[model samples]
Target: MCSHYEAVNKPERLKQAFQVAMPEGAKADVWPGYTGLFIRRPKEPPQEEGVAPWREAMVGSFGLIPHWAKDTTVCKRTYNARSETVATKPSYRDAWRLGRRCIIPAEAFYEPDWRSGRAVPTRIARSDGQPMGIAGIWTGWRAPDGTIIRSMSMLTVNADEHPLMRNFHRQEDEKRMVVILEETDYDSWLDERNAEPRTLLKQFDPARLTASV
Candidate 1:
């Protein structure tokens, strides 16, 4: 699963890609606890309804801690929710059922290849070096004082047999990668579409993708 990634790193890049500004002070490199941006429909009424209509950009906790969780500690293990079981997983089910979809932007994400019995850090990015619009889910958590703390989690798919992805992770574990959405398909992914979003879970073309250790 993706535990770390680098964002586009420039305000102009974000505006060009998503028509949204990078939040002030948001870190370019993201980890479990790092603050980063996510795109989702605003909850307020008169909601924008097009493919990307009414989307709002917010800086939130990267690892999801369900809105109703008793504490934030649960976020440590909920960073990446498996697409196949996301709708049924305890930590992610509610958000899935309620349409808490989002996009996590990243320039590159890191994984480890254990082909040589050691953790080797590898970076995955588009051959063009543009930012990847990663599919994700988000929700708002309430603090003790009634303030809301938003958080999000990346959606991942099994990649055990993938030509590029299979090289990562320990040999004994299942290989998985975050679902990266094409910019043109952003609206479909954000809205309720075709009843099965899994249909959009295509693995990136390793040919157009570059990976380096």
Candidate 2:
């Protein structure tokens, strides 16, 4: 469960990596309930045929705000949705069933390492220093005031067998890591045609990641 992460925070990087414009007032760091950027399928398809943009980047709360939520505080607990239950969980099932998948771009994410009998905050980033495209789900919740609140949640899977990811969190708990999609899978992930894109929720390759305390 990742609650803190370093966002891309650069216009050039966002354009080059995701080919989407940077969201207005995007933050450098994101935490639960904070605003962050997510890339999802455009609401309208391209009218032209040649090289149409397939992704649309938008700023939203780091935690997901379901339609039934009374207020925005629910985001704090909905930031990370387990992949196994996303399709059935009340908070995330709507987005999952509607194929509202997204990509959460980040430079790095933080986790706690408990190898020494004490929790030590650690940073995990790609070994190559490229931005990461984490798999997620997004939705728009209308508030009582008629304002639409957009939010998203990172999708995670069991990582007990992962060589690198298995090192984080408490040893007594099941190891888990966010689903980081491959560069080539970006468009496919945002495609709404695949109602249940469970195949794309594969664990990230640990060899490409480096962790430091």
Candidate 3:
């Protein structure tokens, strides 16, 4: 699972790489070179007639609470969702089915490995240097005092035979990588009309994605 990412370029660079509209009033958080789109659930009331389009929001470094949780600490354990069982896991099932569908824009992510007991960090990005869309889920949780806390988590799947990730992943433990979406599948994945897990899962194609460490 990706724990760090870098988007050192301007938002315009991300726009060009993803070919998507640039987010308005965007700000940069450079500690980890964080840029690109990070999404959260809207605080507005749910529409009675139709589903509202996913809204964007900036989240803190380590906070991701589910809507129904009594406390926010659960989020710490939920930074990443395992693809093999996310659809059935108690923490992610509801969000995966109906509540949360989001895209995390990223340029490159960092992976660390223990090489001879030393932590060696590696940067992973596309060879072409295109922006990538990581699949995620979000929720809107209400606090006791009526404050609504929005949170999100990234989804991960068995890693492909990508040479870059092999060094970080274990041979026996199913290798895991973030779920990346293609241009054509973005709409369908975000469309509330098609929230079925099967339909969403089919949109991911490992062949179009390339990584370098």
The TM-score measured for candidate 2 stands at 0.95
Q: What is the TM-score of each candidate against the true structure?
A: 0.91, 0.95, 0.72
Model 2 C-alpha lDDT versus the unseen true structure:
0.91
Q: Which rank order by TM-score, best down to worst? A: 2, 1, 3
- Per-residue lDDT of model 1, residues 62-142, tens digit only: 888787789777777888999999999889999889888999889999999898989999999989978899999988889
* Better TM-score candidate (1, 3): 1
Q: What is the lDDT of residue 16 in candidate 3?
A: 49
Error of 3 at 4 (Å): 1.7
Q: What are the RMSDs of all candidates, in order?
A: 2.8, 2.2, 5.6
Model 2: residues with Cα > 4 Å off, grouped in runs: 45-52
Query: On a 0 to 100 scale, what is the lDDT of residue 72 in model 1?
Result: 76
Arrange candidates, best lDDT first.
Answer: 2, 1, 3
lDDT digits (tens) for residues 96-138 of candidate 2:
9889999999999999999999989899999999999999999
